[model samples]
Target: MTSTDRPLQALLAAHPADLPVPAVREALLQCVQPLTEREQVPLAQALGRVLAEDVVSPVDVPPHDNAAMDGYAFAGASLRPGEALRLRVVPHTVLAGGPAAARLGAGECVRIMTGAVMPEGADTVVPHERVQIEGSTLHLPADTVAPGSHRRCRGEDLRAGHSALPTGLTIGPAALGLLASLGLDRVPVVRRMRVACLSTGNELLEPGAPARPGAIYDSNRHTLRALLTRLGAEVIDLGVVPDEPAAIEAAFRRAAREADAILTSGGVGAGDADHTRQLMQRLGQVAFCHLAMRPGRPFAAGVLPAGDTAAARAPTCLFGLPGNPVAAMVSFLMIVRPALQRLMGATPQVPLPVPAHCTAALKKRPGRTEYLRALVQRQADGRLTATPAEHQGSGVLRSMLEANALIVLAHDQGPVAAGDSVDVLLFDGLL
Candidate 1:
């Protein structure tokens, strides 16, 4: 079968009943395909958008050999190793962005400013302080200045016809500056991926509403929306849905119709009501409903129908995360974020683990991977230390705000002692 055909089934067949972290990640990378739609947008609006094609440099950066600093330009061959070198200073000064200076004659140097083109036949510059001026003569002390120093060569930053930015790169501030340097007003970038998010469970209520008995505020949708926005996906907030079959199905159908991906938190956990799960099975293919991971073991992935018509929009990718506040956020960052990035036509990057010393002892089982909420601090010696947050429960949403990183414990790993070196995933970039 083709890779895109029943991709969820194929992925499931390759894994055990309870998916591991690596296998779950591999499945996401292999199953999701980048979107093909693209649009031309001005560089001002292109930040966070993925490039559709390579941006080739039309001309050499700097465009000419120039002085790297405010200094005098002279031929390097005229300098002797052990003796002071003296040369007559040309009467005219060369300013940056002005006309180039005339060719240098033997024993002659020209006053040049920073970024000013090097005069013909000159290949070195000596800062003003490095030399002594004696009436129209420039004198350099012995061994103080080296030949060919402080000169920027043509095409040094970027050669003409070379790629300044490659396809699938998410344009950032630096990339925008580079494109502006090439005088490009517009760039071709992949369209933003639309993601619809919703929270389930009848006991959930929106913020600002009066408190009710046995009801808690819905933080999952808000958290998911913020995370999706940071990832550059256009978020469609579907709000909160109850455990009723019709309401859940209606939300799913609308999400599938309006978004490229659908995210629902609740109804997939082992103890939750089965309304959402039943509808998911009836309307789409379910990949894996559970995983072997702490704070986020219950997870689901698949695709759902966009509309009833045969020629309707393509099936929308589905990410059914756990209902618990902390678990939902962790699942989205660990699994769903990568898939969404791939769908946006951008290359997903693995979060590199930063090794840090744990300040507190931790207990763990051997068969499941655990992510502990931690506040990571850099000591005066540049060493990082991770201290676990006070409460580590999945439903403790406040702990997420209290921590800036997660200490990753491997599946085969056991308990961790104080001062043990452990890998941590910092939230600076990921969040």
Candidate 2:
């Protein structure tokens, strides 16, 4: 082993096996750190990338004091209590994007359009519908309009020289608009994370191939790719590999060289043909091969050497998921997602569980945590109720299809009775 691989060796030695969900999450997160690679990209291409540094606004968002809507601009000091106010209309109309209007004379008001710059010496606005206009005179009833109403002050949206977007924030649609409003052409964002994914098992075949006895189509890679893509990762799709140790080792070496992290589905169980667990033991430092969780119990994580002496790249993180389809997806959502976020220089966010009433009875053991496929519905009274899917088997991918959320049963919790409250992880914002 190289000198760079020593830290992971120590980490693996210190970690225990068959950890609980929270312990496993904490341990894996503690092992990996964020990458420092960043680049300047055009605002159009920066969507979904993490900000490397805080973006300070060079100018105020609105840039100038402007009208929030079509209105008449005048000094608020002219109004008298419980008395009608009358003012002569200025001849010029202040249009948005047009030149600024000349200063208003006493008892004079200017017609303004939405987003139009407020004329000089104006501090209030009265909308057209709220006032009466007679020829060149503008009339307003007492107490009908308030001072500074309908005027959008400069820097009200965002002040100049303030942090427009903080570091580590993901650039979404709203962020894009904010950057555009600040007149920023380019932004510095952390580089896209590289993740390599593949499937193993001799019984697996591609989708287009002819049906064969005892063979199943490989769906894990496609599912993994979609998950990685949604998280703004650059996925390296290493297609299906047989259960041979030589082929598996070659795939691992290639992934370690090209990607920052590696994800493998299948061959993590203790079967004789489970070469993934064996290869992970041989090629990487194994943190843990099992977790006290249902559906995805056979999970593995550690650091793999890049094995490229010339480039001397840092070790790659590995996540060995189960062969079952539902288990693989659940494992990705519950554990692997946040770790990958940390590696991308973004803050790790774990989905919080909300209390929901369970509509059906659930039988669960006391030693392990269980995540049940559930359909969560908001009741008429605004409370949420969760119903477990008919099929809860790990291989039942349809269970995941019918579920919009997962009912999280704690490790020490026992069988749940009908109408009992349970913690649920909603998939609305998570997926």
Candidate 3:
């Protein structure tokens, strides 16, 4: 069978209604086939892009043993107990670029700046604040210095000829700085994933247009496009499609032919006017999952054939996000975002859940998982606490705006009382 003809078993369960959130997520991830396209880009341009291969350090970080503080550099062996030791300071100070003019004597010290190379026989540094300099003499504090103290050793941060970053790591600001330290002007990174995004409904109007009765301005189209772009994807906006099967079919076909993935909001639920799901099944293999999750229960995923003309291209992964703004955003973060990352050649990672205590009682069912919008608070005692946002409704988009995290209540979990610990997924985390 062709790649597009791949069985639904890999992506779909026998029945979606009975599947839990975790099972649905695992099945959805199994459908992904990471893209192979890669290109070399400057380190400055690689931010938020996934690395295509492992990067090795060509030289040691700092390149030499240097002083970690601006202070006096001297030999520790000369320090005597209960004698109030003092060392004669050298005539000249050593800056960060070079070493001292003469080897440090047993009872002599050199005034050294931060990052300056450690001179011969000197294995300790006393900070300028810790010692009193009196006319070229460094008076040490009694019982305050130790051997190998405050010295930054060579290759401490990164050794020469060792793996600096593994493959599939997303290059962030710190990563760019690390690569700059290694003098890597350019590196190979996975190309951006192209996603065709849209909103589908007849009662929806574009933002600037007049909204009459039974019609509301389309918000998911803009939000989904922004979300996709924020994740380093090249978003091809397909705009709002009316609730016509033919119109929906055309949009899906066009998106499949042009983009790496298709993200649609609305028409995945079981409604008479929901033609997106029906058209998707006719055009490709789609799985309609009724996950046991709050905010987002109805979700859909599948593959859309791009046709044979683009033989090098694979079938476009399709994500049918929910119509509600909060539900759509939650679904994308929990499910579609991971799928997109995989398709973009990013390393497989389970998003970390931060532990926090609930500030108030939370009502939940035992059979379904919940993704509630919460304001994660850092207590004065250094403990983390999560307070649910007001009006926790799927359609309430403003609730999502006030949240810094999503309280992830498990499928088997029931009600949570005050002071009970819960795991929350950070909203500020990488998409």
TM-score-superior candidate, 1 or 3? 1
- Model 2 alpha-carbon miss at residue 4, Å: 8.9
lDDT of 3 by residue, 1-431 (tens): 12442334543445545457676666666768888889999877899999999999999997888899998889888877676788999887889887554787668988889989999889899998988888987788777877788999989999999999998898889999999999899989998899999888889999889869999998888888888888889999889888888888888888989999999887788763677778888888777766678888777778888877776788888888878898998888877787788888887556799999999998887988899889998989999999999889899988878888889999999899999999998887643
Model 3 spans with C-alpha error above 4 angstroms:
1-16, 379-383
Model 3 gets an lDDT of 0.83
lDDT of 2 at 395: 92
The parts of candidate 1 lying over 4 Å away from their true place are 1-11, 14-16, 308-312
- The CA-based lDDT of model 2 is what? 0.86
In TM-score terms, which candidate is top?
A: 1
Q: Per-residue CA lDDT of candidate 1, range 1-431, in tens? A: 01253545665676656677766776777778788889999878999999999999998997999999998999999888899999999999999999889999999999999999999989999999899999999989988788999999999888999989999999999999999888899999998999999887788999998999999998888988989999999999988888788998899888888888888887786676568888888888765457778889888888887787533467788888988889988888887888888889998886999999999999987887888999999999999999999999999998988999999998899999999999999999978
User: For each candidate, what is the lDDT?
Assistant: 0.87, 0.86, 0.83
Looking at candidate 2, the ten consecutive residues that score lowest on lDDT are 1-10
What shift in Å separates residue 262 of candidate 3 from its native position after superposition?
0.8
The superposed Cα distance between candidate 2 and the true structure at residue 373, in angstroms, equals: 1.6
Which of the two, 2 or 3, has more TM-score? 2
